[model samples]
Target: MLVALLLLVLALSNEVRVNGERGGRQCGANPSLKPRPHSVSILEFGAVGDGKTLNTLAFQNAIFYLKSFADKGGAQLYVPPGTWLTQSFNLTSHLTLFLEKGAVIIGSQDSHHWDVVDPLPSYGRGLEVPGGRYQSLINGYKLQDVVITGNNGTIDGMGLTWWESFRSHSLNYSRPHLVEFVASNDVVVSNLTFLNAPAYNIHPVYCSNVHIHNISIFAPPESPYTVGIVPDSSDNVCIEDCTIATGYDAIALKSGWDEYGIAYGRPTENVHIRRVHLQASYGSTLAFGSDMSGGISNVVVEDAHLYNSKGGIEFRTTRGRGGYMKEIIISDVEMKNIDTAISATGYCGSHPDDKFDPNALPLLDHFILQDMIGTNITIAGSFAGLQESPFTNICLSNITLSVNYASSTTWNCSNVFGFSDSVFPKPCSDLDNPSNYSSSYLSMLSMKGKTMVSGSVSMKK
Candidate 1:
């Protein structure tokens, strides 16, 4: 069963209620749902909700017609109870795509059905391949005031064929995401269930004011590279009350990749993630880059439950990745049956291209992880900062992880500096000294650019 259905089985109302508005948790900007002045049903556009019918033309025609209402208080396109098969479609600004109860939007299984689009500016090339990538099932570009909500309607990506092709190396382009929003603002994706995404489910890139609340995301335990929610190169984001289980990172924050991301110079910041139950069979519950060339900072993640996962939280990047990840706080987290509770490594990713400067080094600083409790953890943490550019000001407080390490060190450290207090299992002696922070800061300030740097739990089981 999808975790979203099991976790959200109790709340069956057809209303938008953010945790903040309900008067319990105040973690994100409150974005309300105002009813659209004009509403149209998909049925009127000749869209048959039968699972076998392909309604690609119907969606495109409907959106084209709805674009005229952009100035007329926007509009709503209601999808009633049925499985609507689509190839790919674009969304208009100031529009609401509401899926009613038992409504489903399934992606076409044929790879050729998806549109081929150019790669993102920050990525320079396709994520998995060198050529252009396929467009997401639902795409929005340079729009505003878009909302994708429903009474827990499901968006199913029949991704088995895509995954099979990827594994066989027969794919020509990178797989398409389930839904993607690019360079948009005031976006809201709530009260929905996303399943079996080909790659990522709900990817908001180069966007702002994105609110993703009260949603469920699930992929099979064996699915490959199926991430839940990825907020890339965007800011002012809120993700709460979500239950996600996948093969990869439940929630991954990324900016750009290698020199391409460095050239883009856009960082992902001002994000709030809370009250999320995340699980990953082959990746971290929450991750930050392996492609963070555009920087990721000022992120707050709290009140999360990470259980039965391979890794809890990880920060991943490598040399030739010129970016910074700092000013982050992760608190009030509980972890169970995790392989690695926390980890940050400098040598953990591949470069996008050979043109990337081998000297571009990343900066990791000012990270605080506290108020965390874990049980049945194999490794507490493993911090491997770069020798040339060491990670600094890492503060760990009020953290307790029950780990049974027979001979290996509970916490592995290499060229990393931090301070630890009120932590069980006895962290490395390097973290005991807060005095090293000054030297590391001075070292970073004195150095210039272009320096040479050296670098889940299965749910079914």
Candidate 2:
């Protein structure tokens, strides 16, 4: 009777597991939980959450049904608790994909199932390589009022196979991102967890009015090209109250790639990033560009914290990148154990091809950094502009840093025109005396304070 007793115990355990999954369907009170007249459950579409069943057709049918009811206030697709394996699926306008707690949408590992899409017009090719790109797990294109939020549910990209292919140099097309919104407008992605993205976590390209907050993006420290959130060629974007720990830049703002981008001429502007906590083992806490050719302007980054990151507040663009980065403001930043506190370099990464124009020099101007504090910094700051096109109107104020390395070199400035006040370890002579322009400098300080306060209020909403 010993064997019979063991079998009874096993059956009881399975019953408990099933009961737990059924009971914990709701995580917390979601704002989108208001009674919807047109709501459907994925279970009704024969989606088995046994963690092994391929639910691609189930998801497709559900989305098709929702699309049919688009004019009637759309539909809400509820994903219950379990691991639902599915391939890439297109998103619909005015549709809400809500996942209950313990529910996970797992990306299919088979590359044959993914759809390949054409390259972006501004990029001219895939971001990492030429030719087309594989679609993201959750793809939305030219849609309006899309909402991808849930009660802390997860969208897991089982990226080991893709990452292995990239490292082995056997990739023909570009790897897929976790969630991408292409040419869409009025998007909201919040209250979710993204893990093990194949490349970038969240990429919103050529979109407008995007709001990303209350999320956590994570990957292993050794994962390559796993950037956190990228707002590429988008405008009026706000990212706040997020914790990002990734292998690449926690937030990399881009416009486009090289000469192809110059012809497109769509600039990314009016971006506000605040209250972000970043942890990076291999990349920057905040990186502007290595591929900014469509121009990036009117960006503000404030009230950020970085821990053990490789770099901090970096602005990088190569020679062929003809974009202009201006009117950027950074304030109230605290960093610890960072390699480089601040950097603005004209040369950072390589161009897409040799056909890129050598005469295209990026313009960097009107950059201000104030009230910055850091500890255990390897290098205080490095600002190097192109000799032919010097950076103009840069300013630094109320900076305090403690260098860990025992080196005579504290600050390196070249081909830049700016001023510094109350800066530690001294500043390069390229910066003029602040007393010479006290009136305008004081006005700038006042403006910075106002911007910071206003940004905080706006970000909370």
Candidate 3:
């Protein structure tokens, strides 16, 4: 019995290593890479407290100590078992936040007390920032080769109080996120329990070679909450074996920013999310936004389980979001009580407020959804904009559904099995375009087996 328990605990451990760019195994146990060269623990840098209340001064001292250490390259910062409360913390290259068992890092809930600086300076290991410009809040400039792992520890964001205020004001001055990794490379965050984020749960922006695994992310179940993972035009990232429950999109990928994306020459690409379980409060379980800063490509989501999500499998782009979504492959997904099984819509016309100007592009093409099973599919099919872009080369195969026929429209299409007459057909085509075909094409894309739904073969034309 003791051996079995130990094996179970070992299976849950989040040990990550240098995995290849979508072609190699995670390198934690690989003998090729050695341990991090140096370790600078936070306890050694004056972090105080025994897992409770305001340890603000201790953390401040640690930051200043890290500054001195940064002058001569960085070192790993370790936080042992305790509940330490503070505003925010910064990470530099070669630094690691190793939270041992029973350690809890709690954030203060007061947004006004939470101060942040603008355009955080780059902390490049060797690259020099411009002489005049200093760093921004939580400066992580050019930070690379870092790992933040919480083994049986909790990183609490104390966000319930802020969530209440966010409901009152949607666009009022928002607070900073709980944890953010910006402009970094070769970063890994695994085996942590992140809860009650003030804003977004995790933001890895403009990063490369990033991996996040086995994180159990939790937020408020009510409405008007934030997202789980907002990868703003990031590249070469993988998030696997995580449990994300949020009010907004569970995982949101932002790429094209109207004119900003094209000007910056950056698009969110090469992302893979697999073996994830998500439960959303309001928004889609997995979504590509209408506010994509650049464009996104080469994304794959497989072996995921979603429970009670507001919507599932969504692709939305608006007039200001000019990025295209293509080369997406979704397979072996199981969902329960979702609003939309699949939704795709694009932007039309233009918006001048966006800094990254968007151009017209296909909403979704070369997308495949295979081996998906779901129930309560309120919105079952794909929707393309009439005035905007149309989805091309979209295919759904080996999908099975168990929905009420009275609420659904019809279900029968090429290559789809196990749908019913109640399934609705979301029209996908360029209807609002004057030059293209104006007529809308609406059809059910899957049919239920006769033994599955009332022993009748309901055909649709």
Give the best candidate by lDDT.
1
Per-model clash counts, in order, read 6, 0, 33
lDDT of each: 0.83, 0.80, 0.59
What's the TM-score of every candidate structure? Answer: 0.89, 0.88, 0.74
Candidate 3, poorest ten consecutive residues by summed lDDT: 442-451
Q: List the residue pairs that clash in candidate 1.
A: 281-456, 282-456, 309-457, 310-456, 310-457, 347-455
Off by over 4 Å in 3: 1-34, 50-53, 63-74, 119-139, 170-172, 347-363, 410-461
> Predictions ranked by lDDT, top down?
1, 2, 3
Off by over 4 Å in 2: 1-36, 435-461
TM-score ranking, best first: 1, 2, 3
lDDT, candidate 3, 216-329, per-residue tens: 888877735567887776776678888999877898887544555545546677776778998887888898866563677766676789878877878776655556776565
Quality of model 3 by C-alpha lDDT: 0.59
lDDT of 2 by residue, 1-461 (tens): 32332233233324322322231111111123343458888999999998899999999999998998777777789899999999999989878888888899999999988899988888888877789999999999998777887899999999889889889988778999999999988777888999999999999999887888889999888888789999999887778789999987899999888998898898887677778999877889899987789998867676789878888889998788999988776777999999888989987887767778989999997777777899998888898999988887777777898888655688889998877766786778887444333344334433543342233211111
- Local distance difference test, candidate 2: 0.80
Model 1: how far residue 181 lies from native, Å? 0.4
